[model samples]
Target: MIDRPRRLRATPAMRRLVSETRVHPAELVLPVFVREGATEPVPISSMPGVVQHSLDSLRAALVAAAEAGIGGVMLFGVPEHKDAIGSGATDPSSILNVATRVAAEEVGGALVVQTDLCLDEFTDHGHCGVLDPLGRVDNDATLDRYREMAVVQAASGSQLLGLSGMMDGQVAAVREALDDAGFTDTPILGYAAKYASAFYGPFREAVQSSLVGDRRTYQLDPANRREGAREIDLDVAEGADIVMVKPAMSYLDVLADAAASSPVPVWAYQVSGEYAMIEAAAAHGWIDRRRAVLESVLGIRRAGADAVLTYWATELAEWLR
Candidate 1:
C-alpha cells in the first residue's frame, strides 16, 4: 500500500505533474478537401462538420488553421474532371495544385502547406496509378506519374508533398524528379505504412475517390505488422523526410515500430473513420466528444508519432491552447 498509484490521481494538479505524454498544437496537422468549381462549401455526408471547400472557403480554412496554431494543413482535391490517366493530377492548373498555391500564399510563413501527391482523387477509375493493358496497377508507370506530380506540387510552393500513393520506388522517383527539377529542398512525407482498411470508407466519400475494386495492390495489407515496418524502412532509405503509419488508432504497433527505427520524424494519421466513430458515439450521447477527441489524439502521440494528421486538428489545437 506504500506505493499507492491512486495518490497521483488525488488531484488534477498531481495528475498533470506526473503525466507521461502531452499533445501540442504544433504536432497536429489538418487535412482539408478542396473541390474544383464549387462556389460554396460542400458537406461530407459520412463525416459531420467536415466540408469540401471551394477556393474561397479553402483560403478561409487556411487562415483558420494558421490562427489555430496547428502545424500545417494537407490539401486533397476533388476535381470536376476525371480521366483514365489522371491527367489532372499533374496538370499545373489542377485543383489540388491550385489549392496548394492558395494555401501557401495564405499561410506559407505561419504553417507548412502539404499537398496529397496521389492520383486516386483525380482518376476516373479510382486507382492510385494507371492501369496496364492487362488491367493491373502498373507500379513502374505510376512512379513516372508521381515523378511528374512532385514537380507540379513543388511548383505550387508546397512545403511538403504527402506521397500517399504507396507505389513501388515512389519515394526515390519523386525525390529524383524534384531534385532534377530544382525542387531539392521540398520535403516528402511518405505514407509509408498505409493499410488497405475498411476504416477508409468515409475517406472515399471525402475525396470522391474513384476507386473501383480496392487499393490492395498498392496499399499495405492490414494484417501484416512487420511489412508495415519494412515499408517505412524502404521509404527512409529512399530519402523520405518523414514517414507515416496511417489509421493511427488501429496501428499503434506499426507507429511505435517506425518511431523506434526511423532516422527522421514519424507521423500517424487519425483517419476519417476514426473521427466518424467518435462523432457518432458523441452524438448518441455515448461518449464525451471533447474528452474522446483529446484522448484519441493523445494516444497517437503517446504511441510515438512525432506529429498527427487529423480532421480535428484545428479544434484540438484550440483545446490544447
Candidate 2:
C-alpha cells in the first residue's frame, strides 16, 4: 500500500544493504565427536556427512576449522566403556579431554576450543547424570560430576565449557568448582533453553548414545516460552558467560526471547535432525542446498542468535568466503 516493498527490493545490491542480519564465518561453531578406539574416522549413517574422528583425524579437522576462520569447535567424546558414574567425563585421560588439548594446541589461539561438560556420552545408562535407587536422575549427584568436569575441561585448555545436561544449579556448581580450582578465566556456555525434541536423533547416533528414555524430565517442554526466559535468567545469575537454545529451527521463539534479554551472548544449536532434514531434501532435489543453507542460517540470525553451532560450520564458512 505504501509502495515501500518495491523500493527496497529494487536490486541485489539494495537487498544486501538493507539486510538486517548477516552471517559470517566467525559466527559459526562446529560440533565434533571423537571416539576412544577408532582406527580411522568413523562415519555415522544417521547423519550423512558427519563422522566420529580418531585422534589423528581430529587434529586435521581442527587445523582445517581454524584455517576456515570458524568461531570454535565443540568437543564430545565417545568412550569405549561406560559406567554408572560416567567417570570418564572427569578423567584427564578421557578421549574428550585429550581431544580438547589437541584442538587447543592445533588451533593455538586461532580458534576457541570448547568442550561439552555433560555425561550422556560417558554414562552406561545414557542419561545425563547418575541415577537414584529408583532409577530417576539424581540431580544432586550430577552436580558433583559437573563440578569435576569443569576442572577437567579447563585443565584440558578448553576456552569454554558447554553445560548441556539441563540440570538445576549446574551453572553455579560448575562456576564455584572452577573458581576453587583456580581456573576462573574459563567461561561456561549454559544450554539454558534446551527442550525435549526429536531433533537430536542423529546426534545420539553420532555420539553412540545409549539413552533408555527421553530427557523431558530435565529438558524444557516446547510449549512453555516463559520457562525458557526463566532458565536464561537463572543461568545468568549463576555466572554463565553465554546461554544457548537447542534445536534452533523449531525453537526460534525461545531463541529470540533469550537473545533479547541475555546480558551475555545468545547462541543456538542447529542440531543433527535439522541438518539431516536439509541434506536429505537436497539430495532428493527437493531444495537447493546452497540457498536453503543460507536461508536457514539467516533465519536463525534474524531470531537474534549471536552465533550458531552447526554441522555445516566449516562448509558454510568456506562457501561464504
Model 2, range 125-171, lDDT digits (tens) per residue?
99999999999999999999999999989998999999999999999
Per-candidate RMSD, Å: 0.7, 1.0
lDDT of 1: 0.94
- Candidate 1 lDDT by residue in tens digits, 218-315: 89888999999999999999999999999899999999998888999999999999999999999999999999999999999999999999999999
Off by over 4 Å in 1: none
Query: What overall lDDT goes with each candidate model?
Result: 0.94, 0.93
Count steric clashes of candidate 1: 2
| Every model's TM-score | 0.99, 0.98
lDDT of 1 at 103: 88
Among all windows of 10 consecutive residues in model 1, the one with the lowest summed lDDT is 209-218
Q: Model 2 misses residue 275 by how many Å?
A: 0.3
